[model samples]
Target: MAVFGTNETKVMLPRNIADGMIKETRTLSTIAKLSAREPQRFGETEYITFNDFPKAEFVEEGAQKASTTGGFGSVKSKPHKAQVTMRFNEEVQWASEDYQLSILSQLGDAGQVALARALDLGAYHRINPLTGSVITGWDNYVTATTKSVEIATADADADLRAAVGLLLNQPTSWGVNGVAIDPKFAWSLSNLQTKNADGSPSGVQRYPNLGFGTDITSILGINAAQGNTVSGTPEAADTKVRAIVGDFQNGIRWGIQRELPVELIRFGDPDGQGDLKRNNQIALRLEVVYGWYVFADRFSKIVDAV
Candidate 1:
C-alpha cells in the first residue's frame, strides 16, 4: 500500500500559495537514494545535450580530420535510454492537498494512459512494485489573469472562486464537489520540480496543464462597462458568463525519447517564461516537462492503465 494509507494523497497544489508553490518536498526512501534531498524529487537520470558534439580543431591544411565537422548552430540532442528513478512525498498521516496536486493527478493519469498504449518498446521495469511511482507524462496550469474593464484585481479572487464553484455545481456522475480524476488515463506519477529558465527549481509537478476554451476570454473573465438596464440586467453587469479557461492561454505536451521509467515530473516556470522541459532525452530528470498546443483538434489522446 502507499505510505499515505491506501487513499492518502500528496498535496498536489498548496492552497495558500497564491504567488507560487514549492519546487521540492520531502523525499521517501523506499524507492530512491537521496543525495541532497530536493524538496521536489526527480525520476530522470542522464540526458543528452548539444554540448555533446565532438571536439573540433583547426585542421592544418589536411591533418587527420578533427573529431567533428563543426556546424555553427546545428547541434541537437538525440534520444537515449537514461536511468529512471521514481519518487513520492507524503505525510505519515493522510489526505491533505494542494489544487496543483489535483491538477497533477489529472495530467499524470492522462500521460500514463497515452504512454502505456504507445510505449511499444516496453522500457519501464517497475522498480517499486508496491506503488508504481514510474510515470511518463503530466501537466501544470497557471491563471494569467487580467482585470476586466469593470472588475478589479481585488475582485479577481472572488470571481475565480465563484467560477470554480459554478463548474463544480455542474451535473456529473459523482457528487459535484467530489469530482474524481478521469479513470481512462494510464501510467502513474508522484510529484516533481519546476524551474526558472535559468533552472532554479520550483515546487510544481508537470501534468494536467489543460486548456479548455472555445472562444476569447479564456484567460480573462467577464469584462463590461457601466450601463443602464435594458433586459432586467444592472449596469456593469455583463451577461457573458464565460469564465476564463486558464489552460487555453498556455499549455504543453510530452513524449518519451528512448525507453526508461519516468521518475520525476515538475511543472512551473519561473521568470514568467513560455517554455518547459520535455524528455526528448535531455535534462537530468527522467520526466522533464515539454510543450505543445493541441486544443482538442482531434480526439483526446491519453493512456489508461486500468
Candidate 2:
C-alpha cells in the first residue's frame, strides 16, 4: 500500500516585494517645517536649487593636479567636505527671517530627504554617524573634572609656552595630548597681539575651541591647574559675543561647531563694533587655520595653513 497524502499546511513565509508598491515612506520631505533647535533639513541653495527654493551651493577645495604615465594617471586633490551658510536676516521688519542664522549648520528633515532619498546623493556630508569626544587631539576622552586655563589676552609666546607646561601635568590618559585652540585665538595673540617678551606684558593667549557637551568643567575644575585653565572671561549678552578680547581669545574660539586644520570663528556686534563697542565700524573677521575640523560654508573646502 503506497500512502502518498500531501501535507497541505506546510508553514510558508512572507512574500517578496512583488506588489510594486512600497509601504513605508522613507524621506525628509514628508515633514512640513524645519527649525534650528530641531534641525532636519538646512533650508536653501543646492547644486540644483531651481527645484528646491532657498538654493544651496557647493564649493570644492583647492586642488593640485599631478600627471603620471598610467591608466588615468592624474592625481587629483581631495575634494573638501560639505557645508552651508544661513544668512540670518537681522531686519526685524521681515518677520519670516531667522535673526540668529548660523553660518554653518546641519540639515533639516526635508532638506535631508531631498538630497538623500530623492536626489542621487554622492560626496555630500550627510551626518556624522560616529560620536566620540568632541576634542580629538589626545586619542582619549577629556573628563568633566579637568581644569581649563584662560590666556585672557592674545596669543603670546608666554601663553603658548605656558600651555605646553600645563598640558604635561594632566592625568596621563585623559585626552591629555598637546592642546588645541581656535585658529583665530592662535592668530589674535601671535600676529595682532604679538608682544615683546623683553618688556611688553605677556600679550598672547590661546582661546578655547574645544569639544565638549557643555561648560569647561574638566579644564577649569582641575585643582592642579597647569596649562589647560580657561583663560579670558567667557561671557555673552543680547545674543552676541560681547567681549572682543575675550571673544577672540576665548568666547568665539569656543563655539559649539568644531573643525579641523582651521576653525573660522567670527564675532559680530549690532552697531558694527567689537566687544567694547569700538566704533570705526570694524567688524572683527579673519580665518583661523592649523587647528582642526574647520570647513567652509556651502563649500566643500578645508583651508589649512602649515
Candidate 3:
C-alpha cells in the first residue's frame, strides 16, 4: 500500500546474502576465476599494458648505455550495469519471518546465477545479457583475438593443446595459465578414449581421473572452470566457439563493485509488466556494476568448423 521510489527507500542486501552471491558468482563464472581482478571505482579505470618488452644489453664499463624503447598503451574499463529483478506474491510480506528469509535467500541465489552468466556472456561474447544483444564498441575474447584452433573430433586433446599453444606463441609470449570451457566441451574432454595398438577402443578412458561434475577445477594441468555461457548457442550453421584458453592473469582483467543495491517495488510498472499494486505482486531488484578489458591477444578460442 506504500510507494517507494527513492534511493533512500532501497535496501542494501544483507552482508551475508551479498557475500554468498559473490561466492556463487565466482564459482560459476569461468571468466571470473580465470581473469585478473583489479579494484575499480564508479568511473572508468585505466590499466597500462606494454606492447614490447625492454631489451637488455651488455655495455662496456663507462660506455654510454643506449635507451631501448618499450612500447606501451593504456586500456580503460567502462563499467557496465547489470541487474536481476524478480516478482513475488505480495502475501509473502506477511508470511512467517523464516519464510521471508528463505525467499530472500532464494532470490540471492538467483541473482548470483544471473550475474555469473552475464559476466561470461559480456566478457567472452560481448553480449549484453539484459537485452540479449551484442554490446557496441566492446570486443570480447572470441571477437578480439585472431588466434583460434579448430576442434578436432579425432583428437580433442590435441585441439586443446593447440589452443594453448596459440597463446604461448604470441609475440609477447602469453603463457597459458587458465582454461574456460563449456560444459559440452568439457564432456568431450572427459570422454577422450585410449586406443589399443590397432586403434580399437581400449575400454579405458584416457583421463580416468577427470570428472564431469558441476565444478571442473582442472584440465591438462591448467586450472579450469565450466559454464554454458562460455559457448553461447550459435545461430544455425555457424562455427560454434567451444572454449577459451589464455594467460588470464596478464591478458584480461575484471572488476565488480563492492556495493549491491536491492530495491523493493510496491507500486507502478517498473518492468512494464502491469502495475504491481493491481496485480498483488511485489518486485525485488538487485543491481551491480561490472567492468572488464582484454588487454592482449593472449587468448585463443577453440571452435568447431562450420
The per-model lDDT (C-alpha) reads 0.25, 0.22, 0.78
Task: Give the Cα-based TM-score of candidate 2 against the true structure.
Answer: 0.20
Assess the local accuracy of residue 192 in candidate 1 as a C-alpha lDDT between 0 and 100.
25
By TM-score: ranked, best first: 3, 2, 1
Using all chains and alpha carbons, the TM-scores for the candidates as numbered come to: 0.16, 0.20, 0.89
Candidate 1 at 51: error in angstroms?
12
Model 3 weakest 10-residue run by lDDT: 1-10
Q: Where is the poorest 10-residue window by lDDT in model 2?
A: 29-38
lDDT of 3: 0.78
- With a 3 Å backbone cut-off (N, CA, C), the pairs that clash in candidate 3 are none
lDDT (Cα, tens digit) per residue for candidate 1, span 1-306:
222234322222222321121111111110011112112112232222242335657778767874574333321222223232233232212335343245344444434433322221111111112133322332111111221212223323344444344433434211111111111110111122356798764656432222211111111232211111101112222223222211221111222333222233333332233223332211112232211222111111111112
Q: 2 or 3: which has the higher lDDT?
A: 3
- Cα lDDT tens digits, model 3, 1-306, are 222223445766778999999888887778878876668887677888777887888899999998887888888877878888899998877777677777778889999989888877877787777666776777544446888888766677899999888767656686888888877788887887899999898878788767653467888899887777776543112227778888878777788954887888888998988999999998998888987777547788898877
Model 1 ranges off by over 4 Å: 1-13, 16-53, 59-125, 128-306
**Could you tally the backbone clashes for each prediction?**
44, 56, 0
- Decide which is better by TM-score, 1 or 3: 3
